[model samples]
Target: MNANMRAAAPTEVLRYTAFSADPDGGNPAGVVLDASALDDAARLAVAAEVGYSETAFLTPAPQGTEGAPEGRAFTTRYFSPLAEVAFCGHATIATAVALGERIGPGELLFLTPAGPIPVTVVGGDGESGPRATLSSVEPHSEPVEDKDLTEALAALGWARGDLDPEIPPRIAFGGNDHLVLAVTSRERLGALDYDFERLKELMLRLGLTTLQLVWRESAGVFHVRDPFPVGGVREDPATGAAAAAFGGYARELGIVPEESRFTLHQGEDMGRPGELTVDLRAGDPRVHVSGTAARIG
Candidate 1:
């Protein structure tokens, strides 16, 4: 693999862990703070070398691309180890927090292929570390056909009875697309052995970012696992994009109140436990996901 980042401008790659205060507890992402001169190939090479599920490339907003001021707003792109993706939440959070440390905590706009995203960074007090919250694009969910659900279950090695009847399968979109599958029990959710190639083919055909496997723990707490085959990763420790999509799915399906807040526990099965806070407002269709990030050496 060509794993090299070469360009004229400064191309420092910052490493950080998103969705947890501990460096080893959350999803790790590579953040390129200034990638103005890097081409797509160079960015991809850098991401491959970083060996993270996703790496974010940031540059100043180009002229006439959007109304964003040159230095204030950024044009961002996300690349996995294999290819580029429309959006990636964990990397976005890591990038936001990295920018926050340099520019001070505030709001920053990122122009992504999915759309314009608004991210707010808050400085941490003595009690907590720096955190970032991203508001997703208008989210929507569509019913999943029986055939698709059946095929997905087969790839996941799960039977129909293992699924949670209350939360039906659906395709949810919050910046990126995700297949939301709710399991009946935590045990069922924990045993995740899937046909990677088969699932990757299905996801590629359907343009899905990840399979959001979930189990509702209580009224507001849930456990989630994301199988990201297309990204060249077996599983994502903490998936903020999937969490946002799942929040939208839960709200639209009436599983939760229109205006509600929920907690998602993820990566525990993988030993990198993370906590993501999801919020859904009554009037707004967008989903908000919040998590802390820490720099990693």
Candidate 2:
């Protein structure tokens, strides 16, 4: 029975959520451990097989099959039901936790299209599943021009006055580019009426991946909503990558204190609430977004 035991389950596919514990609480993702066995079409079929928005396909780990405790990591690729993305934060989180369950949780390194990301699996507890936090690659942000800002505002049907003076407009990047627009009023953030097609077109034209609409509730806390027209979704519930990017943007532009740790509350308006915590170090460029996930049945 021990010799007959296979390392991987027959299904080879696992489902988990990012940023929350409840099954219905967070972003769902599909994970495939040994996608090397499947061709592109087969892998894609497997992704569509799971029917999640995005699924992660992993390449065979490395020359050294470095076992658990310090768990094995591999090159990871993300694909939506439609197409591939440079990266997906939620899927990365889900995949990390899945691997942790098998390898017994420690440091797992993922070589992503964007770069190498390090994930630490903090092992499971009595009733709780394992938790993993991935530190993003060198994060950075740039100023969004006035002209482009106007167009973005137009696409979202949001006026300039709606923006918060403290947190100005900026384009941020962790693995993907997101235009961070801060709204002054919570009402404006809650009233998320936007031109879907128009925003999508604008995003494509500008090479933007998502629009990070944020309403700062306080110095250490914020309410965030992401408009992801490019991903073919109206919004992302909890965006770990975007939160990491925002941490960089805020720190660089003096929007927040030099070394500040903050919490972002998102998807409340959509009713699938999630929380993200971003920790910023004084000299380090890597942004860390931490959250726990649960299996979504």
- Return the top candidate by TM-score: 1
The local distance difference test score of model 2 is 0.82
List candidate 2 stretches off by more than 4 Å.
Answer: 1-11, 44-51, 64-71, 124-128
lDDT string, candidate 1, 1-297, tens digits: 356855455568999999998888889999998888789999999999999999999988777655564455898999999999999999999999999899888888899999998899999975557899999998899988889888999999999999899999999999889999999999999999999999999999899999999999999899999999999999999999998898888898899999999999999999999999999988998899999998997
For candidate 2, lDDT tens digit of each residue in 207-285?
A: 8777888998888999999887676677888877788788888888888887888999987887788778788878878
Q: Estimate the TM-score for candidate 1.
A: 0.94
How does each model score on TM-score?
Answer: 0.94, 0.90
Residue 43 Cα positional deviation in candidate 1, in Å, after optimal superposition = 0.7
User: Model 2 misses residue 40 by how many Å?
Assistant: 3.7
* Ten residues in sequence with the least summed lDDT for candidate 1: 1-10
Candidate 2: residue pairs that collide: none
Q: What is the lDDT of residue 297 in candidate 2?
A: 68
